[model samples]
Target: MELEYDTRYPSVDDLRERARRRIPRFAFEYLDGGCNEDVNLHRNTADIRDVELIPQYLAEHRGSDMRTKLFGHTYSAPFGIAPVGLQGLMWPKSPEILARAAFKHNVPFVLSTVSTASIETISEITEGQAWFQLYHPAEESVRDDIIRRAEAAGCPVLVILCDVPTFGYRPRDIRNGLAMPPKMSVQNILQICGKPNWAIHTLLHGQPNFETLRPYMPAGLNLKQLGAFMNKTFSGRLNEERIKPIRDMWPGKLVLKGVASEADADRAIRLGLDGIIVSNHGGRQLDAGQSAIKPLASIAESFGDQITVMMDSGLRSGPDIARTMACGAKFTFMGRAFMYGTAALGNRGGDHTIAILKLQLQQVMEQICCERTEDFPAFLVRSEITGSAGSTMSNR
Candidate 1:
């Protein structure tokens, strides 16, 4: 379909800047900052940008088509909205807005387990087209119940997270009262007061809560209690033992997200996973980890035939999407970019961001004379960068 987006904000950087100005400082930092020094955070995008695609203008090309097939569904684009927790905190009703847009755009929207909207709500919004991501719950009963809820909601895919065995030490979140034993401070209140637009919408929507986990949480729990509850509830660690039961129970396409190594890719295949998302939790968990694209190149080359290889974490633009695909990522997803859009433009943010990404990708595909999304790898200009350990990443 022909796309029309806001000309004022043409890129994600523009949306991010606007989002920063529009939302409170703490919320923006939570969405924007990475763990520790953010070394991996900046490296994610930088390494991807270093990847060059060879344009073949002389080749015969009818047109470019971005339609991509994955897990028995053909999507309009190769990219989807990666799961983001507490989306409502970033922008009220942001998850639902993005879910509606994803459904309309014929792309997947993976709802985070901790997102503001419940599975049933998002499923209703998308007409059972949305996917659900599973965070590791402590009890088998809770895990099974949540999986059952996802199945009942008509979730086509169950993406289980593997990267966050423990919470990353984000100094920004700790200072902003987003960490364990969270306490709202006067400084945070003043920042919120400064952004009247954000404050008004937040007030209108009510405070963001873990809507999906509300059943398990006690009523009227304070901020500190809420943090304690979360800590006690989710173990945040996934091993072969934990995954076996979920794999047996879930009757949908099973995906393992936060894969950053070839051994883990092999493990996913051995465990009968339908796919693996080559990610580093968007550089949120480990500051010392390698950029997702670096491992993606090896993982895709090694296990692409055995299991689907998709990627997230560091893709910010259409060209970035093209770069990852050229590096062997079967499909791509973006988290902060979509959140930035919703926080910046309110309801129209979802549609506008999707439109701009689609248009941007179309331009790249046509310029490279690539007719289909699957043809992206043929246009890749392989370059190598050696790591500190002497291993090389072809993605560079």
Candidate 2:
């Protein structure tokens, strides 16, 4: 909430080379490709930058806060904004400019049910504190009218995803035809006429559809009949009889986003779920798996106290969210680092990528005198080059 960004793009690889020179190489390779041959997306950020953090130079210090909390709500930080599916084709209104920068930085901003804004316009731009993934609908009355429009848009949390189940052999989204009713080709309209400010802000924000499945589509279906109505209306696999009826019809916070295993974090804690993100989809669904920090360190060391074990694939910074919260991930999410900061600073890319990840995680919690954010697991670094046991390192 104290933003002034554009310090020459202070990293996320300089906002991914200024969002690959301001979009349109098939929308920056569909927000930077990942399936097959990406090899678990470059080993999910090279195994989370091979986790390392240790800095108690004469311990005893209390000077870093970064709030956090989760599930019961506190979040000034602990990473968020990991739901990306055609976010205004990468920039135009980029999901209401990252749901108004995740409601002016309180945090959390999930939103993608094939997003392009909707669900009462990002719950009135995060007034309802955005969070709602759910790509399930093979029709249970369109998944109970999208969980009654995310409980009448006061959505607290509801994720759901469960890895793409299929559709990730992404050869740059199949040579940029970008699947599902998306073959605009003529060399993709000459690479969108060479990105004239991303083709004039996608012609004043018009073509990015799927606005929460436009009340179950079918109005003027072109583009291969809207990709055959999104492959005959969704269903990407999730068991326990489709998650015990969305855990008995969603009451509130219930995550479960593509968990990588510990037997699906013991089946999202025997189908009752409250959390479990350990994603693989960021590797764009499989591509010979492994590297979501090796199934988030054995599913946060075997179900991190049974659930709430959050994570996302290859996080990009803030010390890779403090090495995935010192390797246990109580919370973390990052769909292409705030979409490479709104495709490189259009509408100040979500408060300049959440203020350069809260000033590089408060300078690594004040150079590891580590005062909070759960004491970053006492600055981990336990030896034999991080073979677990609370690992961290950086005193070179």
Candidate 3:
């Protein structure tokens, strides 16, 4: 589909700035901030940007093609939308907006278990092409029922989250009273009032709810009850015991997200998972942990052939995606980037962000004389080699 985006907000940074102005501080911080001090958060993008690529200006070149194959499906682009919870809180119907846009762009959109939209709704939007990310409910019955719903809706992949054994200590969330059993304090109300556009849209669309889990939740529960329900309902730590049942039950591809170490990658292989997304939950779960790229490089080196090695944290632009690929990621995903888009531009956010990323990535491919997404490794600077076969010391 042809996408006409707002020319003014061309970059992800621009979208971020606009989103900050448009949404309330609580919503913006929830979408943007990482755990304590955000050191790992900043480090993720910083280190990924440090990767250098050498352009082959003299080489005979054809136009770039961004098409990529993953899990037996050829997507239009190498990157897809990472699942984000409470998406509608950021922008009304943000999950549905992204799911439809991803389908239109021929890229995958993962639906979070705690997202504002339900499984069946996103499946219908994407025509059963969207993937589902399971938060691993505390009860087996709840987990099985969710999986069954996804299966019935014809979801192609089931992504199980492995991080977040305990909630990250986000000071902003706490200060804003956004934590479980969220308190709508006066400060939050004043902040919401300042963003009239956001407030109006929220009023029009109705308040954002955890639509996927609404059936399981009680009606008109207070903020404290909501917090208690969330705490008691899901288990964040994923182990072999929890995963084995999901693997056996999920007929489609099973991917383990939040995998950071070679050990976890190897375990995923041992557990017979279809793929492992090398991520640290966008640097939100661990404040002092290594950047996603650091582990991605090692994991891709050791297990690239055995399992599909993908990554998600700290990627914001097309060049970032290219950088991750050069470091040895087979595929990449983004969460906050798309949210920033929708929050900044409302209905056009998804299409606009995807178009911009596609353009930027294609430009990188053409500039480097790389024909396909998989060939990005050949342009990586030798010093940054992650055990890939195509590391080159010379720029020539």
- For every model in order, what is the number of clashing pairs? 0, 6, 2
The local distance difference test score of each candidate is 0.92, 0.82, 0.92
lDDT for each residue of candidate 3 in 195-265, tens digit (9 for 90 to 100): 99999999999999988898889998888999999999998888898899999999999999999899989
Sort every candidate by TM-score, greatest first: 3, 1, 2
| lDDT string, candidate 1, 1-396, tens digits | 678799999999999999999999999999999999999999999999988878777777898999999999999999999999889989999999999999999999999999999999999999999999999899889999999999999999999999999999999999999898788999999999999999999999999988999998899999889888999999988989889999999989999999989999999999999999999998999999899999888888789999999999999999999999988889999999999999999999999999999999999998888888988887777587212111222321
In candidate 3, which residue ranges exceed 4 Å CA deviation? 1-3, 384-389, 392-396
RMSD of each: 3.3, 17.8, 1.6
Model 2: per-residue Cα lDDT over 1-396, one tens digit each: 565778888888899888988888888888888877888888889878877877777856758887889889998889888889988887888878888987898889898888888889889988898989988878899988898899899998888887876667788877888876678889988877888888897888778887988988979988898888898899888777888888898889888888777887897898888888888878877778788876676677777887788888888889888878887787888988888888888888988998888899889888877767866865777533235755333331
Q: Which whole-number lDDT from 0 to 100 does residue 366 have in model 3?
A: 94
* Candidate 3's TM-score: 0.97
Q: Is candidate 1 or candidate 2 better by lDDT?
A: 1
lDDT of 2 at 313: 82
Q: Which regions of candidate 1 deviate over 4 angstroms?
A: 385-396
